[model samples]
Target: MNAPIRSDATPRLEDYPYRLSDNVRFADLDPNGHVNNAVYASYFETGRVTLMKDPSKGLVPDGLAWIMVRLDTHFRAELHWPGTIELGLGVVKFGRTSVTFDQVVFSQGRCVASAQAVTVLIDETTRKPVPLTDEVKANLKPWIRRGLDLYQRD
Candidate 1:
């Protein structure tokens, strides 16, 4: 049996970290009645924090700051008002002081936009990049999926 393909052709939870769903609000819509291009940033940021701040796993360090070093987004189609949107987040790379996240946003089971970001672990006070600790890595491991298990085919 094959898993259903998502609208944006992204991998499933087996290939990703966590998935979150949201609804477009009156405040989120532009005069055109569709979500604005910039709205995706806030949507992406929402899932980013949740994935790292899971209280059970607690990836966010007490004295550390996980700051965004880079962000890139791709829009597959325009998303309009008053609908359900799903966000998929995964770690594609983990470094000594940073991690790369692949975040995909979907509506009605189709990907409307996606983004990739590089986040650096930093000293909360000084805001400087620091070495990633094993404790943080340990909590993050369960969320890491090898290769492209999200893909339906080899």
Candidate 2:
């Protein structure tokens, strides 16, 4: 099971250890003149994929792959095109076979959306869930969200 999202607290970009910048494309705008709501998922994906897929991160093993199993999203504000946006991600919990992340999208220093995403590590050939290795857990320690009691809970 995944941890519940703590939406009562305000999100700060610095609290997330992993962050990246992306531009809002013209095509992302909806008929209402704001960025389409669905586009926020891709921004969150960029943050996770960039960190996990990098060889130096050592988060993924050679024969294993990470697949998203759940994403609980909260849309907080409207976003317009012709601007840049910031994405933030932090590891919130580590399950026996899955990892959960707290991700946020910020535009002009204000949070536009936030989500709690769960991804499972699976064997490529068998397509079965695999238990997380100690090494992978250690590698993710640096990316935990600050000011959380994750160590004691998980």
Candidate 3:
């Protein structure tokens, strides 16, 4: 008989940026009785924030916000009703003032949804794109996929 794949050998989505919790609520479902596609954005956003900056010991308060420049969501399967979810996030590209985030939602252990977004960091006052801090680079370096910065940054 063939042996089952070990958990350690499994391609862990959490290894890159890490996984976050997502518990579906009644409101999460639409009239169609499944989680709304739009709500996937929120799930991804929360996961990205937590991965880039820890909640308790977070990033410097330089008065900055990450504004989405683009977003793409792909639904692999339908998830209806209340259930626990896991959101895995990873940094694809890090730029002067922007970062590409790839997010995936797993129902139980299978990927049910996926999303990608580019968020440009900006000064809260000027709302203009700014350079990335070394601190942020050090924090997110491990999570970023290799060659993600081959493209230009806006």
Query: Which number leads on lDDT?
Result: 2
Which model scores highest in TM-score? 2
Instruction: Rank by TM-score, highest first.
Output: 2, 1, 3
The residue pairs in collision within model 1 are 7-110, 8-111, 11-150
RMSD of each predicted structure? 5.9, 1.6, 8.0
User: Model 2 — TM-score against the truth?
Assistant: 0.95
Candidate 1 or 2, higher TM-score? 2
Which lDDT tens digits does candidate 1 get at residues 33-103?
A: 87888888999999888887777777887898798989888888888877888888876667779877778
Per-prediction TM-score to the true structure, in the order listed:
0.82, 0.95, 0.77
In candidate 2, which residue pairs clash? none
Model 3 regions more than 4 Å off = 1-15, 52-61, 145-154
Worst 10 residues of 3 by lDDT: 1-10
Evaluate all candidate structures by whole-model CA lDDT and list the values in order: 0.75, 0.91, 0.70
